[model samples]
Target: MAGFRPRVPAPADITMIAHHSVTLLFDLSDGADLAHDARGRYGRGSVAVGLLPGDFRASGRAGEVLQIRLEPVAAAALLGAPADLSGEAVPLEDVWGRDAAQAEDRLRAAGTWGERFTAARDILTRRLTELTRPDTRPPVDQEVAHAWRRTLGSRGRVRVGSLADEVGWSRKRLSARFSSQLGIAPKRAARLVRFDHAAHLLAAGRTAAGVATESGYVDQPHLHRDVKEFTGLTPAAVATAPWLAIDDLAWPASPPPAPMHQRP
Candidate 1:
């Protein structure tokens, strides 16, 4: 997928930050009145990127893009807040990193990975005391997100019983709490995490069969069905769908990650 032609903005140009992890993107694009169609909001352009968690759909009109990726745990630690995110895009300064203006200026000048990461680390160190609230409030479980993350990394599978056991909560309690906090059920969230992994593998050029086996799906067909359910496209279709494909390449494939436990 090299030599990807820079595309004109289609109606749904926004894509999700997949991979079942949190990430940071530095928006270097000019101030185009961009809308996060997923959240249904618009904002002025700036040198800030969001420290976002998994599957938070985002899109905007075309602009010069500058961004840095971060781990979910690292990102959540910096934000020090929880809940499903659906909010007005905020300046990078308000969250983790150095002074928003200074960082933006540095990125504009230095234009190097080192410079961008330095700014990212600065933000991670300086916690956001107030910008802790998600743009939208959905019942989501911090514990489940954390457990789901571990399950993915360890076994590439999510078992509800195991998650509840690890978090020291009953299955019913965990499901209820997860629903209340993330606005999704524990099982559903786990499915998204798995599906997210599948999406990543596909984007990375792993064949559907290999992804299915490695990601712990029963088979390729099962994986295909699940992917279609989570995202309306088949595995092959997702490969070219504007929203998902753009998302697949939105950031460096192997960006830094944060641990889930560090969030609370």
Candidate 2:
């Protein structure tokens, strides 16, 4: 989980970028602070932002907000139907109904960030538990799960063909099934992961040339091209993104992801 509380009066750039996970956001302010991006406008309050394939710039007045990132498989289990989210910001009530409002209330009532975090965790856990009690969404495909994990584990360096081989299916079959379940092709997912990794490295103070080499790009220009494609910004600009400066600190356990934004 992460928090955003802009320091200035200027409406924060709040410019959105591509993300690899399904992000759950709780708007702590009056819900009028942030504006939406091209995919769709996120109505204030609780919403889930789906994986964005490319840049999603948005502007908004600065305010407090909390965020949670869920892996695609976990998101499938927890969110259930509409397991096929693309670049949309879906209202939580659409999925959780009135319970979504109640959960957001819990977060809003919390006196501290820790309290809010705990509240969010318990709420999600309860939802996941409820799914197992009766009629529920089918579990994620094991082959697809393995393929995704492999792609992320290898930092997107692995080929989809090898994943197909490991899963005892042809490249074409694996890609089709994966897309059906995850709403994104394996190749695209890998590209996002690789780009995310490179962006995180840049945000962590790595030079474009260094990040390119370390992130598996052929050269700095190649890295620049990908960054531009994903964020509509040069590598240097992405490196200076205010939100990215907090990514490493917020999620230190994993290879840092600039998938979230938190005003410093």
In terms of lDDT, the best-performing candidate is 2
Off by over 4 Å in 2: 6-11, 30-34, 40-42, 53-63, 81-83, 133-137, 246-264
Q: What RMSD does each model have against the real structure? A: 8.4, 4.1
Tell me how many clashing residue pairs each candidate has: 21, 0
What is the C-alpha local distance difference test score of each model? 0.52, 0.74
lDDT of 2 by residue, 1-264 (tens): 777666555565555577778877676666545555645454545667778734454456636678788888888788863345676776667766678777777878888777778778899899888876556446678898899899999998899999999999999999988887777889988888999999878876789999999999888898888888888889988877655645557434334333334322
> What is residue 219's positional error in candidate 1, in angstroms?
4.5
Displacement of residue 215 (Cα, Å) in model 2 is: 1.3
For 4-101, candidate 1 gives per-residue lDDT tens digits of 11245442244554344334445444454334432344444442233233234444553434444434444444443323331224544455445555
Which stretches of candidate 1 lie above 4 Å from their native place? Answer: 1-14, 17-19, 30-35, 46-63, 69-72, 84-106, 109-111, 128-146, 177-184, 204-210, 219-221, 240-264
Residue 206 displacement (Å), model 1: 5.1
